[model samples]
Target: MDTVTHALIGLVLYKSIQTENLSRESKRALLFTAVAGSEIPDIDVVSQLWDRGGEYLMWHRGITHSVFLVPLWALLLAALSWLFWRIFDKRIFWLGMLAVFVHITADIFNPWGTGYWEPFSEMRVAIGTVPIIDLVVWALILAGFLLARFGKKPAHLVFRAVACLIVLQFASQTVQGLAIKESAMSRYDQVVLAADFQPGTYKVIGKKGGQVDIVRTSLWAEPVLLHQLTSAEEADLQPLFEQNPEARTLAKWAPMVVVEDTPQRLAIYDPRFFDRGGSFLFESMEK
Candidate 1:
């Protein structure tokens, strides 16, 4: 999820809590825990500033987002709350855990996955069932806010319902994406799915040998061919990797890549980001 969505989720988490009996200072501490915990994992973005090796692609959403680090992050937030508010409530730690855990788990449903297992495993668990910026999630959260503000129902209950609806939406979208992926297995050697911003729609990318196809698919409609890409299977990529560190990093980070070999340059790019005849994740070496 994007930073704004994560922040909104943090606010929703805070709103879902029953804070009527808490002191004002405690409430402030809780708010800080929720919002900061939600955003702590993304602090890895700072690695880019020091990434002379061009490994920022693997570093972002890396170990900091790992499940193993969740407890530690929560502990840090809890201690900070204690220092700031002189409050030692266990709820602070628990809420921190919830916020951080939700942040990492939510990231797994998108195409740019986090390193969930971290040191235990380097696998990037990208389900790609949700877009990075999902309008539906925003709408659901907004509805919760409106209901809490104007409706007769309790704020906590309304926000909880919103959370449940978000879960259902992700579950439904994932199931449909998985079905589309499974159906494409017969046609390709490798397959990946990226959910469209519009719900129930997906981009199904399949690779068979050197050929890659990006297809737009939905539960109720026939798959429409979007883009066709070819990889230079015969091209020697070792030189490219040796000369361009970014190329090596791209190869390791991307689930699969489309290789472009021409007289002027040799390039490899993640097909998932292909748009307008180019990709933002492309790495190349001049011939």
Candidate 2:
């Protein structure tokens, strides 16, 4: 999920808490724990400043987002709260854990996955059942906010309902994506799905030998082939990798990639991101 959604989740978590009995300073500490814990995993973005060999591609959602590290992040937030506000509530640590855990878990449903088990595993676990910026999630959160504002029910109860709806949405999309992949299995050696911006829509990439097909799929409509890509299956990539190291990083990051080799240029791109004439994630070097 995007940063805004993460922040909103943090705010909702904070709002759900009963803070009436706490001191103003203690309440401020809780707020800091919520927002900071949610946003801290993304601090890995700073890796770009120090990256010289194109390692930032792997570093961005690396070990810092790991499930094993969630507790440590929570502890750190709690320590910060103690240092700054002298608030010594144990709930702060647990709440911090929840915020960071939510951020990492939400990312798994999107096409750009995080390294949830990083340090132990280098895999990028992307389900690709939801877009990075899902409007449905935003709408649910917004509805919770409105309900709280109007005192329709308890603020915490409204948030709990919103949370349940969000889970249902994830489950629905995952099932739809799996069904689409199963349907494509008979026609292709391997298939991968990338969720489209519009819900219930997907870009299905199927590969067999040197031929790759990018197809649009939806539960309510027939599949449509958008692009047919051909590649030199045995093309040498040493030169391409030497010229653009990021190409190597991209290959490792994406679930699968298509290589394009021609007299004019040499390029590598994730078939999942294929757009009209090109892909946003394409890395190429002129020949």
Candidate 3:
């Protein structure tokens, strides 16, 4: 998910809490805890500044986003809240934990994925059921905000309703993606589904031997082929790896990739991201 969505989710979580009886200082601490915990995992972005050997690819969304680290993050934020606001409350720690957990879990539904298991496992667990910036989620959150401002209902109830709707959206997308994958499996050895900006639409990537097919699909229509790609089965990546370590990192980060090797260049990229004449996630080296 995008940073804006994460921040909004943090605020939504804070709003969901019943704060009518809390002191003003305690309220401020809870707000800080929610926002901080939600955004803290992304602090791994700083690793790029110091990383030189393509380690940033592995480090970003790594340990900081790990499930095991959620409690630690909550504890740290709670301690900071107490130090800064002098408001020591167990509810602050729980709110912090919920915020951080939401951040990590939400990323799993997006195509970019997250290292949920982290140090324990380097595997990138992405369901690819939702776009990185899902407009549906944005709309839902916006509606929640509007209701909170003008509706007769309680603000906490409105936010909770939005949260339930978000969960339903995730469930619907996951089922649709799985169905597409199941259909693709009839003809391909491997299938990957990447959600599109348009709701209910997806980019279905299917691979068999060295051939990869990119198909645009939707619940209401049959799959349509957008591109056909050929992977270089004979390409030796050691040279590419030695010259551009990021190539190796890309191979590890993506669920599957199509390797391209020609006399002039060597590259590997996730076919699901292929667009125009290139992919955003591509890593290449001149031969």
Q: How accurate locally, in lDDT, is each candidate?
A: 0.93, 0.89, 0.90
**Which candidate tops TM-score?**
1
Q: lDDT tens string, model 3, 55-81?
A: 777788888889999999999999999
* Cα displacement (Å) at residue 128, model 2: 0.6
How close to the true structure is residue 124 of candidate 3, measured as C-alpha lDDT?
89
For model 2, where is the 10-residue window of minimal lDDT? 151-160
- Summed backbone clashes in each candidate are 0, 0, 0
TM-score-superior candidate, 1 or 2: 1
> If scored against the real structure, what TM-score would every candidate get?
0.99, 0.96, 0.98
Worst 10 residues of 3 by lDDT: 54-63
**For candidate 2, lDDT tens digit of each residue in 185-228?**
99988888888878899988899998999998898999898999
lDDT for model 3 comes to: 0.90
Tens-digit lDDT string for candidate 1 (44-159): 99998899998999899999999999999999999999899899999999999999999999999999898999989988989898999999999999999999999999898898
Over 4 Å off, model 3: none
Ranking by TM-score: 1, 3, 2
Alpha-carbon RMSD of each model: 0.7, 1.4, 1.0
Best by lDDT: 1
Clashes of 3: 0
